[model samples]
Target chain A: MAIHHLESVFFREKVAEALEDQTLRGALQNATGLFRQRRLAATASLSDWEKLRDQARAIKAETLTHLDHYLPEFVAKAESNGIKVHWARDHQEACQVISQLVSEKQARRIVKSKSMTTEEIGLNHVLETDGAEPIETDLGEWIIQLAGETPSHIIVPAIHKTKAQIADLFVDQLSIEPTQDAEELTKAARRILRHHFAQADMGISGVNFAIAETGSILILENEGNARMSTSLPKVHLAVMGLEKILPRLADLEVFLRLLPRSGTGQHLTSYQSILSGPKRNPDQEGPEELHLLILDNGRSAILAEEITRQSLACIRCGACLNACPVYQQIGGHAYGSVYPGPIGAIITPQLAGLSETKNLPYASSLCGACRDVCPVKIDIPEILLHLRAKSVEAHENGKEAKGFRMWAWINRSRFRFVWAHRLARLGGRIFMKNGQPPQWLQRRAPVLGAWAKHRQVPTLAKRSFREIWKKELSRKQP
Target chain B: MTRNEEAKEAILQRVGQALNGGGVRAPRKHPITDQHYAGRPQTDLDLVSSFQEKLESVGGKVIRAQNLEQAFNELWSICQERGIRNLACSDAPSFRDLTDQAPEGLEILDFPHEQAELLEAEAGLSEAQLGIAETGTLVLDGEQENHRLTSLVPPVHIAFLSSKNIVLHLGEALSRAQQARSFPRTLTFITGPSRTADIELTLVVGVHGPRELVVFLLP
Candidate 1:
């Protein structure tokens, strides 16, 4: 099993590798293209999608502004309903709370649903290290876990794996006969997982929305694994980012409308579970104990800033990922983080800090497709620009920073701008081969060189546009 | 403070400081003003037919029973079609009446407290609180006679929904959900049979939950 850890340090090399894998590119293009089309069609039924987006954005913004108030309200309501709410300041603490809960139950086998929060905290690894076997119940999650890889997409984890490859994985792991049929592969997985579901002692899941009004956690899933995880297991733990809370149950109407459409282009997911607490009646079948972990892993830091705080409003629909051209080319693994798209680019650096993930912000072309398709209208490009500035400030007076400043100074005056253009053309000739800079120059120069390696560097015109305009004006006057 | 309490306090304090805490910013008045339905509002007749169409489109079977005899016939046929020999049912009145008339040789299991009976049954039955027409959703309130496993653990789930329980949209459902002083412990909105497309975006039905969901709508 490949160790699934952030390769942010080798972001460029990772992207280069992903670019060469035709299979990965084909799978991503096919999956993301379908998602983009479905979202358009699904949303076209609604005449007031923009208004709904505005309402969603406002509700999230207002709740975040009063998070201190809503968090306690949610805790109080949830606790009153027989749910034990735990707060974790960081990833380690979050893992400890869960580990304690698991040990307290003396649970040996654990089942988990698809949760980006669990992925962020590396929850499965922590549980396994503590002597509990955590089985991923979601089919996508199960396939990736079998292959010892993390999720490649937020909603569809194994989107990059071909059916043939999946069939092979099933044959190797579950000892099922190798078959090219997707349904057979799925049934083989189901046959094996159902046994674990019956024997599993605990289940862990992620919350899509935590409603403060009712103190309920909403989870949406197309597969019934999440339902099984919560239904069958005696102990269920819901790990949620503290920012997931909404002010009211009424707010869910808009989000519920937006989430399924933006995510998979479905009118609704197969199951939308709204759980408030553990079983109230002795006869009712649900977990005896419900534990809610509210995680604050550097999210408060992002919420402190006005511009970057809106990034916290993400619902994890993965719309931005599908809309991004750069993502279509490189795929999620290239971002080298648990999150691998535009949202990942902004939030990963914020959560992990800019020093290690600085290259992630520059991964985009700032084409604004992500922002345009964003259900909540999170100005993703604006956030990318903000992160770029932060990355620059962190490395103030560094070589690249100095070059940018120098370029900015020269472009401020007409003469320097024209002279710089002339020099650039001369440099172009000296470094050019077939109208593109050589890889060696890119290696030595490092800034433009790095970009030119992946993309074509624009050739300088023989005469400056400014000079040509001036000559034409003079000739017309004569 | 204990370790857990201390952690909770620290997180809340950080959130307070980040959002400028307590009386610093006045609470904004954000009203829930957009009452407009996103999709076209369906007429009363369209609600039933559209609900059936939408549910069927998502891989769920709808058996519209005009009366008690028709409903019983539908259940018998479902058992025969799926080769369901052992079945479990909720204590809902509709299901209880059907259990009395359940076919011979069809073993009827009770909702066991140990929950082992639910696992062995080929099919389980429950009565839905209501149905949402817009999304073709079944709203089940678990605090009632319905057990979560009755619809979940079995390979097949049969739900008995009444025609009058069908609503136009999610807003109506939310209002209905909010009617109680406190929310139910488990409130589920099930749209169709469990499915997945995780493997190369290939749609595969019956992943973990009920592979087949049959709804017998009572007139």
Candidate 2:
């Protein structure tokens, strides 16, 4: 099944709509500012922060290049460790495998920890359609699930919501007393989710890092929901993109040091659960069966390109999202992708296809803040430019391509350039009023109308620069 | 071949084709040894003090005890102060003896119980295999302790750590685990109690995990 996007097609319309929301913009500014400050402080504490980034990037490069050699090795080791490894070629097959597991186990109540891979595959929708209930246990995921919306940010999923809005949402969906106290709200979620944990027969989570040598998967979370979901249930299912692999267990040290600091500005998250496999003994308290689903889901296609493959190194830290100016203005929803911000701008076009998510690459101003804060040192802006060129190439007959061609044509010769400039100035003289384009002119030219909707269009100079230089500057100068 | 095997083969083929294609550049060799943290505590005293400060920074309470007996006494007092009647504990050797020496009213329920009973316990107790001073983290090995839920399901968790087991950094702790005969089924590194700031960026402590973590360091 193709990955479902909330709104990548009409990117400009979504961005405009997002710009109109005052509360969302305020929430985003506060959250992003706080994350940026914390990340800075956290990274500064480490003297080897720069060295760690280089090491992490190198490790990811090596592993991704030789992934075929590691995949089977991981599968062999994980299976020997009592984990049943499943492979899926796409999102549809991944969801189908999970649905089959749910039915096979006769699991009705399924608890889920936050996993972006599952979100990309639309797993909850599939499970709900199959008559199985999948409850999101992470505090932010649960809130968005209740709101019938998607995450606005990767790290803080509900960063777009105000406390008042959350309280109202809680009152409406959870039927709790309406209170804006974050503590009380969190308590209510814990109380309810705990009940679900007690009843759940199956649990699902995402993998942060999968070690090939040890056949172990590491899950990092602040809330204990991940632990509960993986432990309380009889069966545990972990979903991951195939790129989330490391060749050796020892390599985790570099990533472990980098991820928390870059993502949340913490030395380490509250909990890091490293599980090699299911319970070794019946007396132990853990899942009886552990299933690991490794999904390609367009990542292989992304890896096929040298320029785009660096995107797979992302740890989903959200530091780039916090640093991105475009993400700050539009928030995550405007991009209409599970992955957003600068990283999303590059990855979405490649994974979802340039035709469907062409506007995503243009979402950034290419300021390179994402690259600066990226733990894996992914050159996000470079990839963004690459994807933009690909988009233009794919749509060669489109108006944007035609406009570029016209621009190049006019600029090829001084005579044509001067004539075009004079023609534009004449039009400006007729249609511009006090340095603003006339409403009629805006209406006549839809592209100009869209461009001028949120901006001031300066009127062309009364006389050409060359004319002014010849007539005034020449007389004044020596 | 089964469908799953065929899928694996197809994925490997794609990966091989992608790598062998001229599109990808040759992979660079990573350094075998990473630079150790320069700021990590160098001495035992520094490690102890740093561990205490780091753990305390994240809202975990640390109590220094002269010995295991003193640590048990501290645990008893904490339970009494909090009005904890039922305390669940792991079957690990360090906590196994607590059931016999529990104070009059405090009932120490060891693991091997039903999951429902564990959920009802007011507090949980477990022993750490190692403590990381740099991040104030506790490393727990599930192979050594049978009850993984003992430290997770309850609202309050009390952990006992030996001062000698404290390491200077995460790399040291991980290296020690790597040197083991085989990796444990589950190894957890916990820095503090469960927390979240997701709702309007408001920091809320104790979401789904224990709200309070109390560690008694034994000499």
Candidate 3:
């Protein structure tokens, strides 16, 4: 439960099942298409949408390149402002720290706002294991918690469920009279949640950004619940990814404009929380203690890589997922990782390594829809190719000694490579009939065949394009 | 140290300045200064309206006007129709103007205290600098009171913005934000109502923030 990788494995299998399920596919397509349209409309309103994307990309890239400098400053400033800070290497450690805080409070019940990091760490499950009940206060998260399902979309978590299904859940779980009406369902959730908020012992949330210049944890939301989550609860725990740090507080003005337009096509979310330590001095109804857990969870590895480090610039706005054509067909679950989109396909492998998430690289169409819509403007398709190459390299290293060992050994030598290329050319000549591709290439080759499984083999001309282009260029130069 | 500090130090333990001349000091690429942002994206205000038109094209309700007064009237009527009181507003001039115009019985609080006092209110109203149609987000800064808590504390939040402020995407806003002399302590770009599907993957609104957001755009 503490590991995103383990959940990823479960997710991959579940998504594969989801893909084959006709009903699920239909629902996913409908919802993703709707969100994509909304995002497109929202982005169109910005006169310089593309330029803005470029700027965001630049800021994140610049900040991350110098994160070592920024993070410490943020900590110093936030600490000076009176906030307690903690570090977690991974979800396991993150959960332990949160549980410790709750236990120290001796608080039996905890109220939670929506936080993806909590999901990343499986904090609720972890809380339960340690004998604390963590109630999800975010309406969508609350529903999923009650039904025991994973979020279907980053922005709209429970996008896959219907009203009737929710009514049944309420009827079964809360013993409420079942009604298929969405309004009635919402009221039921509200009535039950208000009571939990009034008496919650602790509150937990996720941070959208942590300003280094000033001690600030910025959160975006639509519900009033998070305010209550932190205010009503005696203790508040905020968990965030390390990359959520921005250089200064005013920098938020840009992101504030970007995130809402990209994620759910709203002008702004209903709520934005900027917490500056717990109730300073004498305050009426805020958390007595404030804790911020910043998690690395193998992010440094991605940062270390030159090609993949741009992945860190991601704000987790979920725009790429919504804009992605592939994602529209398959939905987030199909990506089979917490990331679940163009960003996930590129990032999961880097964090987990190509060895674990090998299939994620090939999940994209390379149509560049995700890159086109990214608010932070990550070069997602390029990263997808980069990760794909890494995955292929891992496979080609031929970890297992098998039939390909001899072929790889032969291929290692330059002389052999030349001869092999000529021989391959000759074989291509033999296989060609008119313009039709070779029948042997039709089925799929083996390790080489992986590409062929879902791709088309370019028809070999009498001469390779490289040779023709070289000859023409030579003539022109002379 | 706060949770942010201890954790940042631990992470810093792994990040050797090996990349930055082996120095712990961060690169000062640009100091915070106020100037007309050069790289900030500029689009004719008309394009922003097109963005609004597009959102409306896709089944979203949008209001366009010239200033906060018109935006407020539209917002007031919208909330008043719902019989809402106990509203929260960040201490911005636009939001204050709306509060002044609010009906007598409809209570309005100017954001929350550091202790989150105003969070008890039923509704929240705030001023947003711009609306990005791309993510359907409204971007704001915590420079003013209630700038952070006003939009978050109330269940139903109504945000006011001028039509000129509407942008196409988060990136556009960031570009403009870079031009600020000093960025606020925090920036929040909110897209939809606060939501989470943590339980049984059921979509719920207003979990950690406001559930309903109405943006009144004045030209």
Interface-residue RMSD per candidate?
2.0, 1.8, 5.9
lDDT of 2 at A475: 98
Off by over 4 Å in 2: A468-478, B23-29, B33-45
Candidates 1 and 3, the one with greater lDDT = 1
What DockQ does every candidate get?
A: 0.67, 0.71, 0.20
A1-478: candidate 3 lDDT, tens digit per residue: 1335344545456656776877666767767776678777877766777766766676677678878888878878777766788888777778778888878899878888878778877788888989988998777778788999777677677766766777888899999987876656777887788778766788888888888766778777666667677656768888888888888655676676688778877556655767767654442235677888878887765666556778888888888877777777677776666667788888777766666677787777799888777888788889888877766666765544455687798789978876766777787677745544455665555544544544665554556555777878667875
Cα deviation of A474, candidate 2, in Å = 6.0
Model 1: CAPRI class: medium
* lDDT, candidate 3, B1-219, per-residue tens: 866456556678765432344335445674334522222334543556665654453333467766655666666677678888667666676554445678766876653443344546777777787677544556776443335556665677667766677775445666665576744444556655665543333456655556666667766
RMSD of 3: 8.0
Candidate 2 Cα RMSD (Å): 1.9
What is candidate 1's lDDT per residue for A1-478, written digit by digit as tens? 0112667889988888998999999998999999999999989988788888888888888888878888898989989888998988888888888999899999999999999988888888999999999999899999999999878888998999999899888888878887999889888888889899899999999999998888899999988889889988889999999999898887888898999999999988999999999887666778888999999888887778778889889999999999999999998888988888999999899888888899999999999999988888899999999999988889988988888899899999988988888999999888899878887886787787767765878888888777788888667885
Tens digits of per-residue lDDT, candidate 2, A329-368, equal 9999999888888888887777778777988988988889
DockQ measured for candidate 2: 0.71
Count of steric clashes across candidates, in order: 1, 1, 93
